[model samples]
Target chain A: MKVAVVKYNAGNVQSVIYALQRLGVNPLHTEDQQEIRTADKVIFPGQGEASSAMDYLRSKGLDQVLTSLTQPFLGICIGLQLMCRHSEEGDTDCLGIFDLEVKRFKVHQHGFKVPHMGWNRLETDNSQLFQAVENPFMYYVHSYYAEVGIETTGITDYILPFSGALQKDNYYAVQAHPEKSSDAGQTILTNFLNI
Target chain B: MLTKRIIPCLDIKNGRTVKGINFVSLVDAGDPVEQAAIYSDAGADELVFLDITATLENRKTLVELVRKVASKINIPFTVGGGISQKEHVSELLNAGADKVSVNSAAVRDPQLIDRLAASFGSQCIVVAIDSRYIEGHDIVHTHGGSRPTELETMAWAQEVERRGAGEILLTSMDHDGTKKGFACDLTRKMSTTLTIPVIASGGGGSAAHFEEVFNGGKADAALAASIFHFHEVDIMDLKKELQAANIPMRI
Candidate 1:
């Protein structure tokens, strides 16, 4: 099975590459439209601002290409947010793969911090990503979260309950970093690769 | 929903992973690449690689190790130690590091902080403050907690933020590895004072420790090394506890 990680100006591609290698899969990392379209599975991964990332995708026409993919595709971190309806970061319109808007964490009156980084537990997953694990913890490092109801497969709280993972049609996106999530993360990737 | 995160900190000396207790055990953990793989598989939310050897001979190798590790993990990783210039920050970011953290370098030459923030943008630059409570003051430490600088932690933090630091990794030299609990008082103050993200490092002994940091300190995130490495606390369990405590976590 072939997996293609969509490449752009975003960082965190290296970690995704390493993650696929460990799973005994040598996936292609590229921004080329044809390669991404032909892969058995595709992963849209990134670590950076939303507006600039969208610009890169739009420049290469990858945004339209990603929105049209028929195969199972996964979005991680910023990738997941980019699949949402819109983002507060850089105030960009996302791919709208999922009817969700990514909003910045509102700082609580008592002074809650943003960029909810670290590992938190996942609960109630029915998707392929949780094939072997039941409500396992995953690694996450993000300040913005998607506000999608029902499509959410996993949820974590910082200031309030936020979407952790979302599923729509053949597209799946997780705000958490599954590649860095250890066994549980690996399990999710393996499941995605297999699907 | 907020997810729980488990992180492993790798102290690098001459491109090798080193671990010390109370910041003094000084044992080789393993090859950084291999250990990083181990931690990532064991379910580390993120990994922190701090270059410990201050010698010039080791700085070059540390950068290469970061490149190697970045090529292997599929997670958000932060690299610290001997990072003082925009060139150093660029090299690491170009090497695939998502974030570059600077400590003593930022304190010594605050301009370097502004330069990096301008070149790479503030989101990619993280300022690590190693603080020690000295006579009711949060004194910034340099050279691996061996020396004290004239900079105050709170004051320097604000300065870095103004200069465009995306986040601050605050480690309490007094509470680190001691596991008594985080410097909740200090973390709470910084989180309240700063608008950027605050990662509370040091003194996490149990799952409750994480809850305490989040509830009492109001920290955005709590980073621990020994507790997770030694199996004293499980990441999922910790998240459950945090969730139970009504702290928003991913579940």
Candidate 2:
């Protein structure tokens, strides 16, 4: 299976590439339209500011390419956020693959940090993404989270219940870093690969 | 519930993992890549690689080592020591480091935190503060705790967080290598003070010490070296104890 990770001025793709390699697949890390479009699976993993990432993606004309790709495209972290209608990070408009709006985590108290950074359990996962695994631990490091809605395939509680994973048609994305996540994360990647 | 993170910090000197007693008397632990793999497989939440001798000449070598370990392990790895410039941060992040920790650089140029946070996003910039109590006040130290600065530890931590650092990797120079336990009291203060995650580093002797840091220290993460490096404490066993003690862990 040909796997290609979307690369731009967004975030780090090395861990995602390494994760795929451990699964015995040497995936291509590229921003090339043809390479990304032609790949059997395209993993869009990003970890930077949403507006800046969108600017880079639009500048490289990847915005259209990403939205149009019919194959299984997995968006991680900011990738998942960018797939929404808009983000509060920079008040920037996004790809709108899913009719979603990304909001910052509601820090309830003083020590309630913006970025919910650490390992947290995944609850209520019925998608193929959670295949071979029950509610498990996944590493999350982000301030913005997708609100649970119709497209929410999984729900997680941090400051409040939010979409842990979103699925709409061929577009699949998760707020957690499945690559940085341990064994269960690898299983999610494996399941995506099988998809 | 946030799972308390157990991070194994590897002090690197001349491209080799070394452990120090009270920030001095360096001893070789093993190869960086090999030790990193062992920790990752042993269920360490995150791994920290600090170049003890972070000279300009050896920095390139550290990035190379980071790539080697990042390719092998599937967990978040933070690299620090002698990271001064934006380019150094980019080099480490490009080399597969999930986060780039800056200590003296951030203290010297406070705006460095803003620049890094702006450029790479606040999620990847970690401001490491090596501190020791001098007289009656906690003072921040630089260059591996050899020099004490006028900046107060808590004050500096607050400044760094306000300047947009993702997390504070706070190491208590006073309690480091003591093997007695972590500085839980101050750690709890820092954790309560900062809205961001405070990784309590130093003076981890056993699982009980970790428990104290998590409960009293209220630290989001705890990093230790000698105990884990010399096999005095195993990561899996430590997690078992922490789990049994009602500390939420990834066990």
Candidates in order have lDDT scores of: 0.80, 0.89
TM-score of 2: 0.95
- How far residue A79's Cα lies from its native spot in candidate 1, in Å, is 1.3
Candidate 1 local distance difference test against the native: 0.80
Q: At residue B245, what lDDT does model 1 achieve?
A: 85
RMSD values for the candidates in order, in angstroms, are: 4.3, 3.0
Question: Which candidate number would show the highest DockQ if scored against the true structure?
Answer: 2
Estimated TM-score for each candidate? 0.81, 0.95
| Residue-level lDDT for B83 in candidate 2 | 90
